[model samples]
Target: MATTNNIDNKRYQGLIISIALFLSLIGALLAFTFYTSSLLERNTALIDQTNQVANSAQAVIKDLFDLESSYGEDISSPHIQRVLTRLEENTALITNSLSAIEQGGVITDNLGNRYQLPNISNDARLDVAEAKEQWNVLEPKIQTYLKDANNIMVSSADELAQAVDQAKTSSLFINESLDKLTRDVFSNAERQATTIRLIQVLGVAAIFAYFLIFVFFFVRRLRETDAEALAARRETQEIMQTVNTGLFLLDKDLKIGQQHSRALNKIVGEENLAGENFTNVLRGRISDKDLNTTKQFIEQLYNPRVKEKLVDSLNPLTKVLLHNTSGTGSDSRFLDFKFSRVYEDKDIARILVNVNDVSDAVYLEQRLEKERSQNDMQIEMLTTILNVKPKVIHEFISNTKAHIEKMNNILKNPGSSQYELEAKLKAIYRDMHSLKGDASALKLHSFTKIASDAEDKLSALQNQGALSGNDFLQLAVHLDDLLSLSNTIEMLGERINQTSAASTKAAHTTPTATAAGVRAAGAIDSTPQANSQVIGSLDFDEGEDIDLDDESDSHLLAYYQDFAQDIASRQGKEVQLNSATLEQVQIPERLKKTVKEISIQLVRNAIVHGIEPPTDRRSAGKPSTGNISLEMQSVGQDFIVSLQDDGQGIDYDSIRQKLVELGRFSLEEAEQLDRNQLLKQLFSSGFSTKDEADEDGGRGVGLDIIKTQVKESNGKLNVNSELGEMTRFVITLPKAS
Candidate 1:
């Protein structure tokens, strides 16, 4: 043991040493990389300095070349020699700086990166040698030549001037040769410097790479350290096995499942959970029926919808399979189960079913349920009695009650299965259908048919049952659509009622005839100009009930003549609201009074809502103030009097939401209704979308008065607003044949 300990300590010591060595190597490489980079930067800066000198040298050469090109040979003449001497001095300074730069390993700027240059040591030496040798050979010869030439030039006068022409050619040739030699020398120096710079760069890159490799290992070490920390979690798992729950594991078939422990003595057979079917162990122990119920429950848990880990509703041991989604037990029973879906190493699902049996608790629950059921029944009976004098919201109340009552039945019938789901859905459809029938019986035609249509749609998918996920989604969407339409219808009715009351007040204030027989002349105009083709049509696959509250057909011309003649004469147009009616449409007293009041009012409204000024009308391609039309027609037992306009149609949704905001209804309620229903509120008393506070559209008694008078005589008011298009209010009254 002592030897082993010694070795282990040595091994750990070695590891620490290795770690230190690794760190040291990294630091050294980093330092080397930095050092090399600094050297290169200094050298590069030196190279740049040398290059600037070279550029200056080239500029001097170019000046010499320019001078040669312009003057035709006489450059060596005393007049030009002074200029040549000045250029040579500048060249000497530039060459010396270049030689110093090529000797460097370090020549850096403030930012330390190596400028690219070659170590031109050997080439620079050769250049210095060549220049020295050339200067030595030429210096004495040039001095001797210059003295002789100067003596001759001074003495010869006109003859010396002639020699100047000859000297220029020789001088230009010499300058050219010198420039070529300088360029060749500089090129060799640049090439040698480039080679040295590249070698240094590669060496630095190798050092940088070594540092990166060391960092990579350091990062890997951190991950290994983190993995070593999970040892405590393994210990916690060990403690969990001793927990005292009557836990047993079940295979797919629930036989002596792969895992069972001493804690499950009562639930299983023998010391070992011998390979036996789970049902056999419970057989004759907790009634075969209950035993089978537990087995079947395991099967269901094995195949769950939306993937689950625990089932709160599990039945007791029984032979007959049972499901307890509605919660089984006598009165107050509590069965909380936690079933973990275990998988083999291959991830196949097995179950560890944990059950907590609390029948006493269940017995208590049943008692409460019975009490609740009794209370609900009592409410239903009272509501039924109240239906005899049903208010306007009778349908609404009944539907809500029906929804609540269906819950108990659904719970009791657990066909906790696909069939039961289909059955429940069928029941729901039937209720909605019955509600529609009831609405129709009450003359709530607007609300009835939409619900019936929705029911029919659901019945088509009943065969698929709740197990069909697609079916459930489809049903939900349909229900949402139906609910939305229902809300619209209800809102429309409330709006009409409000409008009628307001209009009644308006009629009283205006001193309009109260009796049905009052003569209210309507203007009949020329035929409407709109194309008869329908732009958009809503198709339900089954069919849609046509809402016939529109104001188009023959006999519209007469209405225009009745109303517009009074206004057009002022403009000197002599416009006639002409008509061709098959009959002087005699309206019922109930409808007749509403038509008189509204037709007269709308004619005046046209003066405001429809017509532009005479000048404006002329510019707009109209004769004058636009014509207003009132048309009446007969279909079956109803007389339809429609007030039509060629004016800006209202924005019903905005107006509806606004009215709801103003405390008429909530946004949620208003949104459910369609545009037709929203517009119905326009006739409502004291309700208007306008913020301008006008007496016209909002007379504190708009179309609502018209609706009440019609309704008082057993008639109905229908509103149709084709916003920005035109708005027409159709009043229908039963003919007294």
Candidate 2:
């Protein structure tokens, strides 16, 4: 197509050139013709002027001769009257011819009629002036003769004779001058005729040359166009036959082009699809929905309002699935369809459609998806074995079981009282939080997923300030999933345990050397020149008096101290944990559990939420390591567990915003809320200042669970914080009776 268009363009340019040449030739011919015609007209005028001069000269001469003869024959005859009139006419003619000779042509007026005289060439002007001089002398003689002849007297005969003689002499001189002037006029006319003929010949020759050149160019262009058309036809046939992909063109009306790949028939399951509407050919192969969608898509592709690529995603034929009906068996195949605009000149002339079979690719993707699921399961198992401690896993399973039992017991309670229901929701929230925390700590995503979902519903119940038994029943699905997963994980745990035990036994059995032999090998060789020496030794004083701080009494504090420091380190902060001695004050076993849980929760919360990192603390002109203190004491009937942190205090605005995010109140209402109300919402489930959920914090369930635990022990929890100064949580539990 491109070659053919190039040939056509060349032919068009050649035609324009030929037209221009032809116009130039015509213009030249017209100019020469006009010039030749003017020359011929001038020649004809000169010839006529010469002829008139000659005739006038002859007339004057004839009239003078007759007058002289008449005067000789009869001096007083009546013939003189006729001769005088004839001479006067001839005289007027001679005068006009003389003027014509002086002016170079027959003079004409604005009306194109001859004036008083014909114009003659100025080259003969001198001759015409001399003739006029001669005529001037002859005219008076003829007039005197005419006057004498008219008297009719014998005495006037001699006067007539004298007049006739003078007239005859002047007439001879006039005749000679007229002849000279006529010859010069004839010479000039001949030269003008020759010029006209030469111009005529040259103009004809030039026109012939222009004609020949135009014909040559025209024929050459025609031949080139034919050759280009033939070449294009051959190339197009080769492309149509050899290309494997289904390629075709569609016009604005969606009619397929005449030439298409042989593969098109196999792809579309149609033969001889050329000249047919593309939509019709596709209708039987693809669903009607796709057909309509494809029609609109192609229509949009033809729009010039935006770039084609911008709307490429709207193409419906992309990855279109078509059934392969050519084969004997009934099966489906996916064909990839693509479209692009074909431009002719600067306009889009057609849309090119390309189809390819992608069934193998589609099937491969399906298989890959199945394998990916299997890989995910294997990875989950590997993670469980690597990261989770057996002890944590065991405890998680046991605790989850107990929590589920507690939830079941709450559901089993038949009381429909709103207050009782609210209490049950609070209890359920604590149990779910504890389970979620254990799952999160152990990195068991499956358990955490189920527990977090249940926690969400229980939180909604707490927000309602009431709940029904049906609400508890709604939670059964999550609980069931958790229970089922727990059993599966417990079995896996047993298998893991068995594998560990076998590995330990195999290691013990594989050992060959005794303890003494190993020690001797480890002991520096004391042989001569050995390069090993013992640098350190163990010392024991078994009989010496010993004094050691009672670690048992401070174990709870120490464990939490270590926990705080570790959490701070992981978060890139430094922290110092200080605790008052609580060994002297007796704590009951149940109260001890409460204190320990509260201390662990508060300590972690302080480090995660309150304490700034070392950089922040130093920037604030404070110690690099934050300070966290745990103090326990009893006052009358209340046992106080106070936890304080010398770090950033609670931001009440942040708490308000969290409440606003949970949709409990608008931002305006939240801001208007009192500080006490804002602090109280810290115990609201799923309300945390942290933006993301992670293993350490941001679940917001810690304080809520702690509040539940305090309530169960008949205690009160109080929070006090000064911005940028300190944050403290005071827990007061009733002393055991």
Report backbone clashes per prediction: 66, 9
TM-score of every candidate relative to the true structure: 0.22, 0.46
Q: Over 4 Å off in model 1, which ranges?
A: 1-578, 587-594, 602-624, 634-636, 657-673, 692-697
| Poorest stretch of ten by lDDT in candidate 2 | 531-540
Give me the candidate number with maximum TM-score.
2
lDDT of 2 at 453: 80
Indicate the worst ten consecutive residues by lDDT in candidate 1: 527-536
Tens-digit lDDT track for model 1 on 46-125? 54555555455455445445444445446567655764564455455444544454354334433675353445546554
Clashes of 2: 9
Query: Which candidate's lDDT is highest?
Result: 2
lDDT for 417 in candidate 1 is 62
Task: Report the lDDT of model 1 for residue 62.
Answer: 55
